[model samples]
Target: MSKVEIYDTTLRDGTQAENFNLQLEDKLKIAQKLDEIGVDYIEGGWPGSNPKDIHFFSRIKNYHFKKAQIVAFGSTHHPQKIPQTDPNLKTLIEAKTEVVTIFGKSWDLHVKDALRISLERNLEIISDSLAYLRSHVKKLFYDAEHFFDGFKDNPEYALATIKKAIEAGADCIIFCDTNGGTLPFELETIISQVKSKFPNISWGIHAHNDAGTAVANSLMAVHLGATQVQGTINGVGERCGNADLCSIIPALKLKMGIDCVTDEQLAKLTSVSRYITELLNIAHPPYLPYVGRSAFAHKGGVHVSAVKRNPQTYEHIPPQKVGNIRRILISELSGKSTILSKAKEWGIDLESEDPEVQKILQELKDLENQGFQFDVAEESFKLRIYKARGELKKHYFRLLTYRVHDYNTLDGRPIAEAEVWVEVKGRERHAISLGMGPVNALDRALRNALEEFYPRLKEMSLIDYRVRVLPETSGTEAKVRVLIESRDKECVWRTVGVSHDILEASLQALLDSIVYKLFLDERREKC
Candidate 1:
């Protein structure tokens, strides 16, 4: 089998997603990352549509890509304009990318309704557009927009459109599921018909997720001998999103025995998925396949036991193959093997028959019953293990008391103030600080009091804090769970706390965050 080419359109089609905007610097950074991951092409953007994209094309020229070619995307010439003078085609040439992709109307419905041109005129537009750019760009691709729907509506016209493009020197013909309504079987039948007519031509598949079959359809296209796969990282695109290359790339390389990317490049898949989401400031969906946080996590006792003996019992592939780690979740459903696996992961020695394992298991169940979730708070669970083994003997600081106050200014701004008292190594300290909210003020005040005793505490800061109201209660009496994500220069960790009072819950999580940091530092020093 031939190696499939990966064309990443995250900077182009991906930006069309709501709230998925990226600055020029972000695009540049992502382009570098895409090149590092060995994508064949990076669709920069439509330079003619937006000033930002134009600036991106200009700025990207400074960086040298080792593997990927930067691609400029645009549309066919307008019916009223000549291809040589069309602004869209002119801008595609000016972008100076080695490769260019332009979409043309394939569906006769679009020719009549969208373009409002005669059928022959649209075909002329496709032929003229590709011919004009073929000489200017080193490689040209024709995206047959709505190709499958067009084929179903008028097979002859659809075939004619691509026929003109091929004759005009298009290097590849990409069949796009523009409306994302094509299913796997439907795509299979259409592509089979199309390929039989043009077996020698290079074919690619571009799918959308409206029908929730984008990845399935893409794989089907590959199974039928399509040599190129176009998608975005994490599937960020207009509407439901494009096919997720994060899932497709691994499936091709690992499952289908295709060498689309080298092993080292494939291992960077998880981090690249996360890096794009982090830059977009969107929460990465933990349930996403392959690279998601929960993709390889196990919670059932039976499943954990089997996986401990052999990961293949429950997992489809090794989590480390995609730069993801296997997670043993601490929950009521977990058994002794789960605890033992988690302990081994954290470098703690424990036998299967250890009594402390059962003790820790019961403690986890009791705490989870009280709204304390340990699955997302592995640091808190690790602390529990240390306490169970009587290893957490050192107390860095003892909290004496804390208070928070909120006030409204005449200017309509709200102010929060917190005062904290703590005792450390026979010495006492008191500090007060103002912050954006009660939780923020409390975190500041506590750090102010403790940073003097443990200077390294200044290095760690809270990155994310989320509050959830437990459904077991309601109204003002409802219990709240606070999850705090903290990070130092080294790594990030999560801790959880639950209380009827939101402030108390926040403080419990904050305390765990600080203690986890201190514990890590001590462990590192001892090592």
Candidate 2:
């Protein structure tokens, strides 16, 4: 098989995604991770558009990479001027990277309407940009923006655009599905035609995911002889997203037997995918292919049984190949076999015939029937397992009573105060605190009461709180389920609680959060 280059544009195109902004340090960190995973090209960002990217290119020069080439991305020169005179081109040159990628208009409609220039002028822009960068950079890739749409609209003009870039010394002519409307079959046909026309030229593909076929289109193009594939780590980009390299890389290397990153580097794919999402502060798409949390999670009884006997029965590839583990989800739908499998995974030596397994299974059913979703609350599920096995320690602190008061202050702003009484290590402690809301006040007061006994609680804090109404059959008095995410220096864990009153539900979850933290502290000490 041909060697396919993995060009990652997470820093550039990915930041365009909503709520996916990253700091300069974050960009550097992601770049390092991508390099470690053996990405061939890392497109830092568009250099001239913003100060952040300009600073990134300047600072990144100090760091040396092992395998990946750091590529500066930018658009072709303005239609009104030569490449050298274009400010964007000048910024690309100033970036001083060995590899530079410049995208130019291929669609006649964009050239005629968006650029408001003739198709002839657009051709000049493409050639001039590639020729200018070719001398300044060791590798110059020309992105034929909207090449598929342009080819379908006017094949002659679209082919002319890439032909000019190749003739003018573009290292690789990358066909782009800028609008992401092209299907896989359409991309295959168009890519094959382009490959035939320029049989000797190196080709690449950059696909977007508007129609949800970016990954398919990209792989089809590669099968049709394109050598380079450009995408983001988790397919994060403007609109839907670019093709997900997390899926594409493994598909290429493991499934197709194509050489991109080495086996050692490929194993880091899941870690890289997760690390990028953490930096973006975005939740990982749990259902995403290959590396997603649910990708290898078996929930059904038959599926879990088959997976336990032979993972290949339900899984396409071994999860550990990409640093992900096979997961057997225990739920109301799970059987004793599933519980046994999950127990083995958790290092709990529970036999299939163990009465405790049946007990926990019944408890899981009853809790889930009450709106407790174990899938989202894994920490709570683990705690239940420990409790069922009679291995759970007693709570570090027990709440005696708590009072929350809410009233308008002199400034007419509502103020909430909480008085918490708790028994810690057989000693009663009392504390009062103020907060923006009743829940916050309760949390503060409870922490204050327990801090004397468990000083380590100072490092833990509630990072996220969510409440979901159960059934809501009773309009005003519906039971609410609260989920609280707590994080310390060590790790993040979520705990859940349910009650008719929202405040009470939140307090239950908050208490569980503190208890879990204390448990971890005790566990570490025991170890």
Candidate 3:
């Protein structure tokens, strides 16, 4: 098998995505993870772009990397300026990295329209940029921006642009599908042409996902002789996204029998994907290939049964190969077989014929009928089962009652005050609090009353609250379902509640959230 160099541009290109910005500390943390996962090159942001990027480059120099070379990214010299005098090129040298990657205009249209430079000047810019950086850095990679589009428009000029980089000592000439509109067949044909033209030149592919063929195009280029592949983690980038290294790396190794990351490093794919998503606070796509939560999840009764017997029956590859696991989701659509499968995974001693299993299944179905979705609220489902089987401990605090009052203040702003009465460990406690809304007031009052008894409750807080109406037919009177995501230092959990009134629905979810946190603590103590 041939080796493909993995160049990660998550910190550079990934930040261009909407709502995907990372702080300086976050970028440093990600760079460490990338190096630990054995990426060949980690492209930190351009040092000349902002003070943060400059600081990142300065700080990154202090750390020792294990396997990856930190590469600084920037554009080629300005059309009117010489290489030594170009600010962008000067910052590239000042970043003090062993490798530098710079992009140049490949499309003649971009030269004339975007840069407003003659075709001859663009070639000189590309050559001078690489030649200058070639002396300062151990290795240089030239990115031919929009190479695919350029080749389609003027193949002669595009080839000439890359030849100039090759002559100027670029270790790798990376042909980029900047617009990401090139089809796989077109990419394959173009890559084949380039390989034939320069048999001895080191080649790479940098693709985006606008056409949804970034992975296919990248692999096709490798098949045609590209030795390096550049992408962002989980495909985060401008527009559609860059090729997802999470999906592409595994495919290159397991599917195509090409080696990019080692077997040991490949095992960290799922964790790396999740770590990045978690840091960004983004909802990971459940259906994302390989590393998604639902990638190896079995939902259908027949599929679950077959998967239980042999995972290879329904799965293309073992979930563990990518550090992911098979999941058996329980829902109203599930059957007894699925329940038994999930129970077995949770270490519960149960069978399909158990009366307890039947009881739990019926309760789940009824709850689903009442607009409670267990698929997204598995923590609530587990708590329900534990309560039904008498394995759950008694409540730490029993709610006697709660009252909320809404009134206008002197300034005419609506204020909500809540009074909560709860019995904790045989004694009753009363607390009152005010909030901007009824839900917030109730949450504050409840926490105020309970915090004294269970001081650990101070650590638990609601991170997100979501509500959805059951049906549009009832309009404002429709039953609403509320899901609350709560997190403590150790873990995060989701709980659900439903009611006709919005406040009541939120209360139910809020109560469940607090109860689940205590329940988790109790289980930990028993263990």
TM-scores, all candidates, are 0.96, 0.94, 0.94
Can you write out model 3's per-residue Cα lDDT over 204-306, one digit (the tens) per residue? Answer: 9999999999988888888887899999999999999999898888888899987777888888988989999899898888888999999998888888888
Prediction 2 TM-score vs. true: 0.94
Point out the higher-scoring one by TM-score: 1 or 3.
1
lDDT of 1 by residue, 1-527 (tens): 88799999999999999889899999999999999788999999999899998999999999999899999999999899999779999999999999999999999999999999999999999999999998898999999999999999999999999899999999999999999999999999999899888889998999999999999999999999989999999998999999999999999999999999999999999999999999988889899999999999999999999998899999999998999988899888889988998898888999988899889999989999999999899899999899889999878889999899998989988989999889999999999999989999999998899887789999998989999999998899999999999999888999999999999999999999999999989888331
lDDT of 1 at 337: 87
Instruction: State each model's CA lDDT, in order.
Output: 0.93, 0.88, 0.89
Stretches of model 1 off by over 4 angstroms after superposition: 525-527
Top candidate when judged by lDDT against the true structure: 1
The local distance difference test score of model 2 is 0.88
C-alpha RMSD for every candidate: 1.7, 2.1, 2.2
lDDT for residue 5 in candidate 3, whole number 0-100: 92
Residue 454 displacement (Å), model 1:
1.3
